[model samples]
Target: MAGKFEISRRSNGEFQFNLKAGNGQVILTSEGYSARSSCENGIESVRRNSADDARFQRKTSSNGKHYFTLTATNGQVIGSSEMYADASGRDNGIRSVQDNAPAAAITDLTAA
Candidate 1:
């Protein structure tokens, strides 16, 4: 199965999206946007930026958990990964986003 982008509305009335891998694991999550269109644009940005390794910024949380953020060319963060127990897991998440995002289908859960 191919990966997919799932867009949904937040409780605060904003919009966000998740990039799910083929196995349905969420590889990356976007920041909340004030509008659905902005959220959609974020998704497109992920698809465009995921192709570049340098766009992925790997980091360690203050507590030492590993994670990564995907950034656009303008240096804006497009999405981030969930905290992982180790750098290897965080790296795998980045790889998953790169391998899956470009061709991922979009599923708009916000549809009424």
Candidate 2:
């Protein structure tokens, strides 16, 4: 299976998305957007920014977990990743986003 973007509604009624790898692992996730269109735009931002290494912000939490945020050209955080146990794992997550986001198909799971 190819990587895919899974769009869904949050419990608070906001829209969010997850970028999953071909093996069905979620490499990246989006912030909640008040509108579905904004959520979709976030996906586009991920696609556009994933290819640029500089667009990814790699950071370590105070608790020592590692994560990454995909930033748009305008400096907005378009997407983020789940915490990883190590920096290498976080780096791998960034690479997964870079490799999969460009061609991932959308799988809309939101209610019609």
Candidate 3:
């Protein structure tokens, strides 16, 4: 199975998406957007930025957990990883995006 982007709507009626690896693991997730087109644009941004190592920003939460964000060339955040228990897990998430994002497919699970 190839990696894919799964688009869906939040309960509050905003749009969001998840980038899943070929093995079906969610490597990254997006913030809510008011419009579906903006969500799609975020996905495209992930695809474009995932190839660049410098575009990824590794961060730590206030609780000390690690995570990462995929940012566009112009510095916009496109996607983010789940909070991880350690730096290794966070790095794995980054690698997952780097490996799976370029060829990932889109799976729209949003309600009509």
Candidate 4:
């Protein structure tokens, strides 16, 4: 789970994780941050990336919004979300990206 982005409970029953994106968007979060870290990870996941690669990438949407993608190897149809922005809209969009990354991770395998 070193390269994988996730929030797991430590033996002490605390949340610990490396909040990150392939590009360098990362943070240090705690138990209360599980939801938030998950959100960040979700955004990183939905930014249109490869399943085999552990690093996450940031992508853009048709509306010119920066976002991310999460891909899984099961060949399923996961959902998508947007990346953060300087404005509230961007933050909201990125929030969606976080919420949808896990779902998006289940999408079909992209072409090599």
Best prediction by lDDT? 1
lDDT string for model 4 (1-112, tens) is 1122444555654444433333334322223224544544443533443333333234666666665433434433223333445345544444543533334322111112
For all candidates in order, the CA lDDT equals: 0.96, 0.93, 0.91, 0.39
Candidate 1 error regions (>4 Å): none
What does candidate 3's lDDT look like per residue over 1-112, in tens digits?
7899999999999999999988888889999999999999998888888899999999999999999998888888888899999999999999999988888888889755
Across residues 1-112, which tens digit of lDDT does each residue of candidate 1 receive? 9999999989998999999999999999999999989999999999999999999999999999999999999999999999999999999999999999999999999998
Predicted model with the maximum TM-score: 1
TM-score of 2: 0.96
The 10-residue segment of model 4 with minimum total lDDT is 103-112
The TM-scores, one per candidate, come to 0.98, 0.96, 0.92, 0.25
Write down the lDDT that model 3 would get. Answer: 0.91
TM-score of 4: 0.25
Question: What CA RMSD would you report for each candidate?
Answer: 0.6, 0.9, 1.2, 13.0
Q: What is the clash tally of candidate 4? A: 12
Clashing residue pairs found in predicted model 2? none
Candidate 3: regions farther than 4 A off: none
Candidate ordering by TM-score (highest first):
1, 2, 3, 4
| lDDT by residue for model 2 (19-49), tens | 9999999999899999989999999989988
